[model samples]
Every structure is written in C-alpha cells, then in structure tokens.
Target: MSRTLFIIDVQNDFTEGGALGVEGGAAVAAGITEYLAEHGEAYDLVVASRDWHHADDDNGGHFATDAAPDFVTTWPKHCMAGTPGAEYHPALDTSRVDVHIRKGQGVPAYSIFEGTDDAGASIGEVLTQHGITDVDVVGIATDYCVRASALDALEHGQHVRVLRDLVAGVAPESSEAALAELGHAGAAIVESGALPTAGAGAPEDGDGEAGTAGDRA
Candidate 1:
C-alpha cells in the first residue's frame, strides 16, 4: 500500500506575521520543510495545497466585506491569487513537492480535495491514480484547512493520519476539537516522529506509542 504526504496550506497568509497568521504557523512550516528534507523518501508522493482565492471577488461570501466579520464563516481577505500572501511560506521547500493544488478560486474551499493540480487533476483523482491507500497530513491552521483535508481524506476512504507536530492551528481549543472530531471520524492523529523507518513498524499513526498526537483523547 502506497502512502502520500499531504501538506496543507503552509502558505504565507497562514504563517506567523501574515494576514491570517497563527501563533505556531512559521514553526510548522519550517518543521515540515525540515521533515521533508530528511524524510522525503518515506512517502510515495508529496502533494501540497494552497488557498488561491480571487482578489476581486468576495469568494462566495468566504471573505467578509463588512466591518464586522464572523471569523468562522467570514474572514478578512487573505491568500488572494498572485499575491505574496497566497504563496507558500518562504521556509517551505516547495521543490520537494510532487504536485501542487490550488483551491478557493471563487468559493470557500478549505479542503485540499477542492483543489486541482497543474494538470487539472484533483487530489482524489491523483491519489486514486497513484494507488495511494494511506495519507499523512501536515501543515498550517489545523482547525481549518488541515482539519477539513483530513476529514475529507477519511471520507474518501483513505487511511488518514494528521501529523500534529507539523501543524499549527488558529486556536488551541478549536484545534483540539478538530483533532477530537477527526479521531471520532476514524482518522488517526499522530506526531511526525512516529513515522516508520525502513521495514520497521508500518508508517501508521494508530500503532504508535503514548504521548503521540493520537493520544489526545
């Protein structure tokens, strides 16, 4: 069974000091870059996703046009297409990414599943085409895009694991809630360190030791 590394939204807008910055966002980006640098060969494929929204439009009400905006459903503009905010964080080594998926063209698309690769291939299509049965997810804003991507992966029938150390969230409470939801939905939450070496324990999060991300329960 082949495995895929799903890097979600490590974009500039999601990192610290950016428009929609999270506290640990920059750390997550650098951590993921370092992880891939060392363990790039651990997975069969590496797919990265970004929020490439339209600059002019409201993005189907995803962005808040009024003064008072609901942070949950509506947000201040960020990650607009062709902008620096939409690009991956400078720390993230995108050269290692096998496929890049851009989502949120003119709508609210949080999941990487919403995006399509350079060849117009969707995430699900690429996974199926490559025979990817297991997926490990990592990136910024765990409570939002990362959470959405992981849940969708489980729904798509892929064995899903979220690497906690490689993810940063908007809020600690929401991030914890998201992880709980993922666990309840059958997605394993694990630390990146628990990923398997050659022929050792399989690269699955469920079998890892205590204190890993899956033990959040």
Candidate 2:
C-alpha cells in the first residue's frame, strides 16, 4: 500500500524560456510545488527526475547536429550535464524528494525507469526497496517524459495515476493523444488531488517499454 510520488523532468530546460519550453511548463512546476506542500505526508517516498544529458557530443543521437531539429526524433541541445537547464525548476520544492534520479547522461532516455539515483541505484531498485505499490506521476512535457514514466509505472505492475493538472506538454494535440494512450494502458488520468490511500508497503513492478514517447523525449 506504500505509494510513491514521481516528479518527472520538471527542470529549467523544459519550463518557459528554456531550451524546449512548454507553454504552461512554469505553471505546472509551481502547481506541483503547491500540491506537494499540501499533501506531502501522503506518500512513502517522493522521487524527482531530471534530464541530465551529456554536454560532449550528441546524446546517443538525441541532439540534432549539422541540421535543423525535426522536433520528433531529434531535438535541439538542452538540459546538458552541470548546466542551469539541467537543474529543476525553482518553483518545484525538491526538499520533498526522497530519491533524486538523473537520466539521459549520454543517451536518449524518456522514462524515469531509464534513470539512476545519485548513488547509481536503478529506479526499480529504489521503488522495490521502499516497497511501493502505487505511484502518482507529475511533471513537465505530458507528451514525453511524463507519459513515458506513467506508462512504465503501469508496465511494472504498479497502480499508476497521472496528475493531469500538474503536467505540461510540448504540443496540445500530441499531449491529448498521450493522455489517451495512458488511459488505454490502464493508468488513471486524475487530478492532482487524487492521493493514494493510506496503507503499508507491498511489492511493485519494474521498468517500461519506450514507445514514441521515448523517441521524442
């Protein structure tokens, strides 16, 4: 019955004025902060992920070079390692985070499952160690990382819920499509206020399959 709050890629590079800024990305960050502040005690763990891509060379072909980015499979350089853009948005109060996961170090990674913690523990290991069974997904880029993470959570056999109000996306049409996909995949598309019920710990699922979400993210 233990639950985890997954804050996915709410970094500077994804917010307004960032390298890949979404329309309401900043608002999403602020709203997530407010949600955590009001319901911080409901979860057994709070995990936050960031796109910490490598600065040297393209990240496993994630960054487009020598040409314009098509914004589909390849994108402009962003969220490089050790850069301000790689840092979480200021509005997100990371003090609530129990696990810090960093992904896309030298590769294209979309789901938080592709990430590892500061100590190099895989996300599945972290979740299992905490005995989490339910997860609430929230963060930026609804059509990308947030979608990937939620799908992965569901794939891992966990009860997954996406906090629709706490997320932003790269495009409206694609975002709506992603939400529909998640709903079809067994995830509950919920508002931020839908908290996990109070309970003890239990075993959970594992990593997810990267679909078009991974390709774009």
lDDT winner among the candidates? Answer: 1
Q: What is the lDDT of residue 128 in candidate 2?
A: 89
Q: How many backbone overlaps does candidate 1 show? A: 0
The alpha-carbon lDDT assigned to residue 196 of candidate 1 equals: 60
lDDT tens per residue, model 2, 1-217:
8889999999999999999998888888898888887778878899999999989889999999978999987999999999999999998898989999999988999999999999999999998898999998888789889988998998888988777777888987798889889877877776654443343222232223212332122
Superposing every Cα of model 1 onto the true structure, what RMSD results? 2.5
lDDT of 1 at 5: 94
Query: Lowest-scoring 10 consecutive residues by lDDT in candidate 2?
Result: 208-217
Q: Per-residue lDDT of 69-171 in model 1, one digit per residue for the tens?
A: 7899999999999999999999889998999999999999999999999889999999999999999899877888998999899999998888878888888
TM-score for each predicted model, relative to the true structure: 0.93, 0.89
Q: Each candidate: what lDDT?
A: 0.85, 0.83
Best by TM-score: 1
Could you give the C-alpha RMSD of every candidate to the true structure, in order shown? 2.5, 5.5
